[model samples]
Target: MPREITVALVQMAPELANPEANLRKMGDFVEKICTEQRTDLIVFPELSYTGTELGLKATDLAERVPGHATNYLAKRANEFNSYVVFGLVIKEKVESILYNGVVCLGPEGDVVTDYRKV
Candidate 1:
């Protein structure tokens, strides 16, 4: 038998500096997509959790990996039994250091892979 998978590409406008609101929006999209079809993976645009224009305030908007955003998305992933991929501003443990990062969450609500934009 041939292997197959369903993927969802989400396009939306993220509210600047409001991670919580963005997360809610993302969760809504996931729920809507998963409800409509059986999806294996969902992909969101870059900086999906934070708006594109983040001047110097990007630092304040930055969060650690497995932080609020990932945790929130993970629940949805597990609930829907699908993988979720999205971008966010990641804060380093040393503080003051941040990167544009992408995360992939497994169907079990675990971090599968994390990549930082170069």
Candidate 2:
């Protein structure tokens, strides 16, 4: 058996500390890619939402899994019926706990898995 998948790698410069803008841009890319062709997977750069120059702002930018960013991207995944992968800063219940993480969203908009950078 042979299988083939179409993947889109999105490379964009995120606004420093501006999650909302970054999310919107990502969604735009998703819509554009899906409309242009049938894509099986879409991948975004690490720390795509929060630019890598966080300094002490990482704490404020960190979010829990299934939080705002995931929720936002999940909608896009379901809308286009494609898998989506992206990286961001994740935080646990405790304020100081944070990890560089990657998340994969399924076609149904459910989280397939989340990986934390150790």
Candidate 3:
């Protein structure tokens, strides 16, 4: 028999340049979804943290993998025992280098992997 996966696709507008607020909103969605039903995976839109039109400001908001945003979502994934995936601005060791990336948090609340937009 083929296994079934319950995936939740969240479509919301992220606050511009306000990652904290965006994170809170994301958390609310996670809680609500988990409360309503079992979710195997949750996916959020691209640029879900800082919103798309950031232009140069994206550099300022970029963060490293396993950073605050990922950590926050990981907690939610662990709490709900589900996998969560979201988009974020990622920064490498070099402050100037950044990537439009997506992070996948496992049910264990750990970062499973990240994919960068080409």
* Position 13, candidate 3: lDDT: 91
Residue by residue across 1-118, what tens digits does model 3's lDDT show?
9999999999999989999999999989999999999999999999898788889999999999999999999999999999999998999999998899999999999999999877
Whole-model Cα lDDT of every candidate shown, in order = 0.93, 0.94, 0.94
Estimated TM-score for each candidate:
0.96, 0.98, 0.97
Per-candidate RMSD, Å: 0.9, 0.6, 0.7
lDDT (tens digit, per residue) of candidate 2 on 16-109: 9999999999999999999999999999999997878898999999999999999999999999999999889999999899998999999999
- Name model 1 segments beyond 4 Å from true: none
